[model samples]
Target: MALALAAPLAACGGGSDDSGADQESIGLLLPENKAGRYEAFDRRIISSRLSTLCLECKLEYRNAGARSDIQKRQFEALVNKGVKVIILDPVDAHAARSWVDAAAEKGVQVIAYDRLAEGDVAAYVSYDNEKIGRLQGKGILDALGSRAATADVVMLNGSPTDPNAPSFKKGAHEVLDGKVHKIVYEQDIPGWTEAEARKKMAEAIKDLGAAGFEAVYSANDGMAGGAAEALKSAGLKNVPLGGQDAELPALQRLVSGAQTFTIYKQVRPEAETAAEIAFRLLRGKSIKSLTPETADSKSKTGIPARLFNAQIVTKDNMEDTVIRDGVAPANWICTKELAAACKSLGLN
Candidate 1:
């Protein structure tokens, strides 16, 4: 899907450049390194596509490691360095607004990537975040089947500072609130950190007892891993867990029947789309026609966005979704320990 430019081309520092003599620089600000995919997949994908799309383009990248202040500083540094476009996965959605506005003032185009930063950004590229949550919710309900009516579940959501967390939580609650016997406990994991999720899960298990909850609604794979750690420590087994991102460990857990399902957003397209848009804007070309969808941001309306679809992946369909599609390599997922399971699943 394409996204029309939300802000005017001129407003984004675009100007006539028939000769293409100027060397353009694009800045990528990622939120954290704790999530392996941000650096391993997202950065590589974005940089690779940018290099292919604009051979001469200079790419400057930084990870905030989930620190809002550090991201703020990084944004300032990029703006001061006069990069043509900045693709930002904000550490704090609301806090990133000022940085977006600041970039606007300098005529540097800002493209909100992965997580939407609330401001007048030139473009936004991400999946339908609420849909991701809904899929997770439905995966849990489906895994539980009729047992959902009698099951107790606990929600371990993402960082409260990220705006997407609320939408995710809201979507999950919509499907889970009245359908389950009890929502034993729910808390937003700060920084979306694995350790925090582990601690919260352990606490929840302790208070509610191992038998109290049947499913875990973890927001992403990192937290799912943490919850798994806690569950293992408590001697809990075969608990249905929902996650997103389809990280390696999560996929492995799904194969082992530890994690029920994960939502795969397919980051390659997202990164490529963001890079394509930034390259066009850098070269003084219009992108209004490329972006077909518009989304509402907290401080702005009609933000041009390329929203991708997210898919639900279980052990049964991993081959068709992530592996067969080449999103995750068979060799990477079918490890030594997972050999038997992989062969049983027809992964080899």
Candidate 2:
């Protein structure tokens, strides 16, 4: 894919650190705080690692709160602030092309973080999103076991504006298209917000009836919470639920049998790697050395990318995955209500 109209301005962004400036400023703009991971994981890990690696580096961070306009302004602000590099997780992938262009015009190199921004960027760091979807599909099937051919499922996907959402949907469909009994309902969450998902789930319940679907394939933990709420309101039980991100709530739910499974995409490495790349960009080092793999964006192909693997987390292996890996705290996962479940899973 060709980059945006501003592709030619890529040279404007940064220069060599010959002087070894005492304080190099870099911007980290996350998509939103709705999923919890962006704040609790991405921002925290990225900032910490950047600070650890470059003691004199200043990290400017912002969250878009699920608004495209806010993200645009934040990007512009980061650019105007004279930051050397900007790591952006766009709220709206298509709309972000202009932001990338703007940054490039200011000589600020952009790193597409988590979500693919539809413009030329220095690098991208994220999980294999399609694999996330495939894992989710397989999780659903594993939960259904031999009854997969007779199970009905509803797909609650992420926002249509997110480029990763389509990749996730495509992969899920690859594994689930003909395997399940029926896909009773499927809709993209407008903003990937839990509230939007809750509203959609309510609609699905009304349209598909309480017992119409046997499982729900929620794109992430936030939507899984929303789906769980709708299911509870309708008095459904043991309905398989699939989620990603492995958020605390999702892990809790997984142990409590409220969620069937979740995908854990080790965020520490992803964040630390992005931080390293930002420092490298500031120092005029080759980003391709760290991210040898490449991915295609709407406006660019052969974009340097570092994609990580994801693991499926279920109640059966919650301890081995989340707890053992230190992804989630035992106290966080083993709540009073979930104590028994946690103990059974050897989480405690």
Which candidate gets the maximum lDDT versus the true structure? 1
lDDT tens digits, residue span 113-163, model 1? 988898879999998888888888999999999999999999999998888
Cα shift from native, residue 177, model 2 (Å): 1.1
Tens digit of per-residue lDDT, candidate 2, span 148-257: 89888899998889999988998898899899999999999988778888888899999988878888999989999998988888888899999998898998888888
lDDT of 2: 0.82
Report the C-alpha displacement of residue 345, candidate 1, in angstroms: 1.9
Candidate 1 clash pair list: 2-291, 2-292, 3-290, 3-291, 3-292, 4-291
Q: Number of clashing pairs, model 2?
A: 5
Query: How many steric overlaps are in each model, in order?
Result: 6, 5
RMSD of each: 6.2, 7.4
Candidate 2 ranges with C-alpha deviation above 4 Å: 1-23
Whole-model lDDT values for every prediction: 0.84, 0.82
Span of ten consecutive residues with least summed lDDT in model 2: 1-10
